[model samples]
Target: MMDIDVPGHIEKVAELEGHDDRAWCVAWNPTKPVLASCSADKTVRLYHFSKTDADTENPSVTFVHNTTISTGHTKTVRSIAWAPSGTTFATGSFDSNIGIWEQESSDEDDEMHGEGVKTGEWECMSLLEGHETECKCVAYSTSGTLLASCSRDKTVWVWEVHPDADFECMGVMMEHSQDVKCVAWHPTEEILASASYDDTIKLYIDDPSEDWFCFTTLTGHTSTVWSLAFSPNGRYLASSSDDCTIRIWERIEQHKWECVKVIEGQHERSIYSLSWGVGKRRGDDGKGEFGGWLASTGGDGKINIYEIYEPPSSSDPKGREPPTHTLIATLPSAHGVHDINHVSWCPRQGYEDLFATAGDDGIVRVWRINLNGQ
Candidate 1:
């Protein structure tokens, strides 16, 4: 079900350099070819790339700066998440606040005076301040109803977003023993997953009592779990950790998850972030096959690519074995000795192969994976 002879290449498309301090996270807009990056500089930058400017055969693509918003957060802006509607987004900061930002319908006439500067106004609609310590990450459910945030206080808070953009504290989960690093929502469901410095991943679901509860805890990593991503189909979850391994957890049954695969020893340092996308697999038939593309970025300044093969047939006598993974490409020294903090795949409808990475070097880079003969 996989083309073993197929190979893929990562080509850098754009390099955004405006943050005065380390860039911590990068997230793509769900419905636009735009990206938002947060940094320790207490600011967030947006970049927009034109589709015609993409050159698949070249080594990189060029992106243009759209706008820069200096959020009033006194501390570092750690994470950002865009809503599915693409009209609103949220940022979690070390100031222990979650800022809700919305795009205005039109830009001011003063901002249009510059020749080559594309500018827009983003207003901070509300600031939710309940975390006792640094807020590490924030995520929105696909339906845009629930917003989840994790903090150094060892708790995850879920908020309900009202029609007028007001946020109400729905629940606070205190299941993790150590600082929570990241939170993610299932692609199509209300299921939420949080990774912690205590080396575990916890899954929470909403019960019939109108409360969120932790139903499962996945424990395998020997070090801190930095980030996590759920597969497009929502059947599997991938986690990156300080142990220099990426663990793949498959949902075997309702509320039961198991680690089915572990990628070890490839990354030279702690893996910080991972994302899943779709890419082409070339075959001898001259036609390309499409498969899942997994990318992991780490402190080693490397971005590695792995391919996930098709699932086992239901009629197989062996039943469901662990899915196989193959290393297809490696982009070594991606940030040139600086640690890459986060890498996020573009969630826009037609841009599966595009992704963005934020680094300690104060740079955010965009990349595209190209398969030959595709």
Candidate 2:
């Protein structure tokens, strides 16, 4: 394989093992030092990590297996997502059900199960069933008041989260012509986006008097769109496709988005997953004017990281220039020939450089980007 030289080195930190089948997705808790992964093994694994010297430049971190949730799904647990509050999480399964899970409040069972299990028993608080086929992805809105799930049934369902694990179906959106692969919520808005095998993406919003409706459709990908992610600032969106390309879209106007960039020559095979994070670098004001880092991985077993940045004021006086990206690092054969199914950056504020990937090898690997040979 040909190597693409880059500035940073991605070093593997830990290999979390437990899943008996292919691991499909990994998500980091928004408020805690926990990471969650789902698998075809019909289980969810949680890992907790801590920093030894948190205040120093080089901190030693250790990851311990927290617990295993034997989600009572009949098929593969395809996707998992954490609520922004970190108090609850949702799981999507090929059995066509979405499970809402929460930890029991009583600290009675603090004993280890076998080798790694620890603290707080989790329970399936709610089970959502409506999809006619496999549920592909699940995501929570920024405020944790809403949850969105898409399925092979070609429909996107939005649910209103309520107290005591009660959930009400808000709307069922049927805008895709084929299997819906992924669903993502806008960073700071109520808007939702879904990608499909129809090679298109549809955006939806609540119409207040009329309920949720499709407002716009994004078209440009020539093949199945596998995943979708919104930028941290919510001004832009990124998508990966089976065509082996990534497309960047800019919200040019209210209720309108246009494709501004197509990233090619990165992955040679289908791109399964991508994530955007508030990276360590910032622009002039120390705010995140420089956009952030975009990480993608898929069938080729490679992990690619890119820095997305906006042009300086002098270069674009009217500020009309769309953000651009450059590949800063690449790790080939990330799973040693097994396809990497998902990549997610740690959502916590101080751990932007950290990320985890789930692979067909049934292992969840943690990695950190070492910049400037640090």
Candidate 3:
């Protein structure tokens, strides 16, 4: 067993014990270590820990799921994501709908251990309807002004959130014929890329005035493109697939782009998870964190941490290896794990080095990436 960072450094922080179906999706609350998980059981559960007031070093926080929410969907939930603020969350379900959930509790309603009816204090706020078939995934733009939903009906829908008025249906993007499995937004641009079972990744871009538009379709993965992510710099895109490989795409001279590096020979089974780090980059003159690096999980029951090293020199030419990179770690069955579905980095930006992942084995594992190793 290779001692990699992704899984080996993880600890089973919590095990939600009541779901009757497979947990398909998990997301860390953008502002906290708290997390939410969606399941085929048709329910979404919220988990958090309340530290003891007296203990310091031996402080033990129990995994307490304070609430269970089930509404706005007629079938199993497939995907869930927390907004940057963490108070509101979005979920896409097999019922072809996206439901908005909010933290609905007052000081009186907020109990440390939770109150009656809803233990954890979460409620479905609104239901979004439009898709003709099951929705597979959903994401919010960096500004949280737009929400993107992808469905098996071969379309990606964008919705605009209006706090004072009824939510508006922005636009629909149809560029795939098969089920779209994943949708990812560029860190800085208005561009969005989606992976489909059709074996193609389509990049969609929207101007400040236009509702949405398709800029390009990246076709390379031989099998279904299971997952996709844009690098922290927004210049490169990393994707993993059932084809059993990880490929990186970077914008080249002018507007053209090319697959620069193919990180292979790492997985023995299908690659399922790809979580890019979410904190400051390695070297920034002590200015601030830029959120570089990445981690991945796959069907081989393993996880990998890929550090993005700085380029050696401008004269080194494009498409060449960076000055230095270290796999740092290879984790097999992280903490004796098996059947992990996905992995996610905490989205709090400039704050956390932690993340959470869930799988068929019914355990949510929390991992901390230690750069200092101090």
Candidate 4:
């Protein structure tokens, strides 16, 4: 066993409330301090942080509800994903439609007074309708040129975002044997990964002759693979599953990937969502903290944080060993027995320590992690 000696703790920053029904997904705007959460109430809510709300010195910040936009989807809005540009977002709904929404000028004259825009400030730009069943998740590529959606129809669809903002169906991958649960894009690459109820994760690559093809399928989970997240460097991927485990995959070659670590017996119930971020590591004299971090939320209503420790050369007498995952902190009932549906880390550079979690309790909670245990 490795002697992991960094103290870690999680502090609740804010509890955002508005949705009348279960909040299914939460996503942070890449270029802004705003956060968007979608719900079973058929509405999407945006949470905004003003200059006062971003007081890093305060240790906790409370964001205000910016707006709530009702999507046209009649069924539950299952997932929300923001584009890299932060100007647009996409929603996957149980109505089997994907809605692309963009920020529009609100008629309310409240903006000049520092008040947020109107509730209906967002407009659906386009609807991509093709799924035969509920669309479970949607994600945009790092460049925002490609969008991927997975469905209960057991199919994954890839779309090309045109210059006019119109989406054209690139190809459909009907490889999963069961309902697709979540889809995620590589942080720095065009590679797309989709998890499914069939206990598999498929990675897709663009092919000029074939449109998009399944480059690889990762297996080993004994139950439904609920979610996936890629490391900031895009070299590693983490997956959570109904089997109550988290699996880590690393890139071995340009087109090859393999599961290198499996974390089991951690959560009491299914692990629903996973998010990766940079964690601070204490120095040799316990002075500093900066390294790889991972957060997982689950059906057990618990949120756990782990430190990804990549040790030094094992052959050297003074060097450390191989990479290992050490649980740093665990918050029980983070959502008060309400299963967390999603957890997303803030994408901004200065706010990487912040994360958001949405749950069946119809609330989204923002958390700040103190890796230094100060």
TM-score of each: 0.90, 0.94, 0.83, 0.90
Tens-digit lDDT track of model 4 for 1-374: 23335477778888999999999999898876789999999999998874454546654555988888889899999999998988889999999999998866655644545333334467888999999999999999999999999999999999999865699999999999999999999988889999999999999999877679999999999999999988777768999999999999877678887887899877999999999887555556432233378999989998888877654433442232334787887788899979998988887776767889999999999988876636
Error of 4 at 333 (Å): 0.5
- List residue ranges in candidate 2 displaced over 4 A: 1-3, 108-118, 282-288, 312-319
List pairs with backbone clashes in candidate 4. Answer: 279-291, 280-289, 280-290, 281-289, 281-290
Cα error, residue 16 of model 1, in Å, equals: 0.9
Tell me how far the alpha carbon of residue 171 in candidate 4 is from the true structure, in angstroms, after superposition.
Answer: 1.0
User: Residue 325 CA error for candidate 3 (Å)?
Assistant: 4.7
- Give one digit per residue, the lDDT tens place, for model 3 in 167-217: 688789888989998998888876788999998888876667976787777
Clash totals for all candidate models: 2, 0, 10, 5
**Sort by TM-score, top down from the best:** 2, 1, 4, 3
* lDDT for position 132 in model 2: 92
How far residue 78's Cα lies from its native spot in candidate 2, in Å, is: 0.4
Model 3: residues >4 Å from true position, as ranges? Answer: 2-16, 50-63, 105-121, 208-211, 253-255, 279-291, 312-325, 335-337, 349-351, 370-373
Arrange candidates, best lDDT first. Answer: 2, 1, 4, 3
User: What is the TM-score of candidate 2?
Assistant: 0.94
Question: Measured by TM-score, how close is model 4 to the native structure?
Answer: 0.90
